[model samples]
Target: MKPLSIITLDQISDALDSIDLLGEMRSAFIAYSSGRSVIPPVGELIIDEQPPGEVHIKYGYVRGGAHYVVKIASGFPRNQELGLPPGNGMMILFDVSNGSISSILLDEGQLTDVRTAAAGALASSVLGVPGARVGIIGTGVQARLQAVHHASALDRDDLMVWGRNLGKCSLLASDLEAHGLKVEIAESAEELAERCRTIVTCTASHTPLLTRPMIQPGTHVTAVGSDTPDKQELDPRILGSADLVVVDSLSQGLVRGEVARSIDAGTITPGRVVELGQILDGSNPGRSDPNHCTVADLTGVAVQDLFIAEAVARSLV
Candidate 1:
């Protein structure tokens, strides 16, 4: 038997684009919520040289879907010294009925970034306000992916960005503008939030990066940071005021300190939250009114990783 071929981030990116991964991820999430998959525990700070590790594993087959995939990934903060990402991972794709390895995908930064951006795109398409003026609250790689995905999903051309470091934000704005987007750099997350109806936060902060007052009524926010327990990008008040707070997975977020802190503080109730998969399945309504606030808290999910792996495998065949 031939050994699984090792794949790189660039290959993953090409595969992701070719397979229309956003739609695939959306369908996979809905099936995941319907009890069709086994999602494992996610441990945060494992990679940070902290107390524990953040590990996630999941196995699932698309409903009326032909394939299954499982992914295991870990984020270790110490990798920075090697000029490498703290996160490194691989995925296994299998045949649906009889579980057999179809392909293996080896990716670190590329896999996570693509799937994360796809989730934001799915959320934007399903819940963002119509004709939204988008705002980005970071200029990192994930931020760039978020900008592209939002543009694809919303047909939006207007984007405003902000970063603590003005030079980085300015450079990012220029890059996006070159991509045919109307990009602007704002002074703060508050300013970006105030100017756009759809806001996406993709930062690596341990504290709140945005507040409630910055958000207008009818705004939709997708918080892509906070994959670890110690990181949070949105204020607790925003959680309390949201008409709907959608998360990629309930079990996953509770492990991360972001939602757990809010829940522990009594600022938000776990019962009031809905999974993005449930919303996609029509089990719960996504956005009931244009005048309401909605928040999608994403801590990342194994299901997404698996789905993307399957897509990449198929493209390779």
Candidate 2:
């Protein structure tokens, strides 16, 4: 047994910057959706302590690939009150050829942040129409990353931000403004929805925040907050009104994602849910018409971790 390549968070971030996250994630989504990748159901642990958070255990492998990944990610929203980051995680790589432990990436969820934002970019590029302004909900790392990524992907200079905390919302606007985007602040999530054609929700709220009537025609909603059974950021009625609803993984989303709640409430159907890989692989048209309301529920997938780990591992010495 040789030594494990203990990679640091900075190293992983640098690696992430070097690759095209959307491209890599597109391939992974295609493979996983097309049955070319194997991913089991995610394991979740919820701690009901003071902070109140959840940890996710995910593992998956690309068929015939050299390496696989197992990721343990956690999100504690109240950690900000303790002057710490809300999300943290690590990834372990394994060599399929020898069944040996390959490397350990202590990214502390940085890769997750990047890949998730990349997925948002993908969703925006595919499901949203041209001439649409981007609106963001939640003033967290994901809101910043997604705005930066989506601004570049959509080639737009305008966006809007909404959050319960006025300070954080202003901070996000300033940050994105420095990135060359004309960022505005919305009084509420509903106002944000009405003002922009594309809305990205990234909060950890346990209740619905964005409702149906607030969303207009031709709007695209990217729901990234509902990764577990207890979390929901979009109202179920919104899914019912959407012309098209896409998810990263049908299996995962149907069980523990926002889509699950929508399904349970009889607002949506399995037949209406389309996997993103279908659009990535050109099997299904992403947005049939420019006026269609599209909602993408990305609960995060194990294949995403496998893809990112493989990319980072290849870049390591």
Each model's C-alpha lDDT? 0.79, 0.89
For model 1, how does the per-residue alpha-carbon lDDT over 1-317 read when each residue is reduced to its tens digit? Answer: 34455666677777766788778888768867887766667533243344334655555555556656666676554555667666666777776767766677777646777889989888988898889888989887788889988998899888889887788788898888888888888877878888888988988888888887888999999988777666888888888889999898888767674577688668898888889999999999889999999998887777787777877876876
RMSD of each: 3.0, 1.4
For model 2, which pairs clash?
89-108
lDDT of 1 at 175: 87
State which candidate has the highest lDDT: 2
* Candidate 2 wrong stretches, greater than 4 Å: 1-3
Please report the TM-score between candidate 1 and the true structure: 0.88
Report the C-alpha lDDT of model 2 over 102-211, residue by residue, as the tens digit: 89999888888888999988888888988699999989999999999888889998999998889999999998888888998999888898889999998878899898
Cα TM-score of candidate 2: 0.96
Root-mean-square deviation of Cα positions for candidate 2 versus the true structure, in angstroms: 1.4
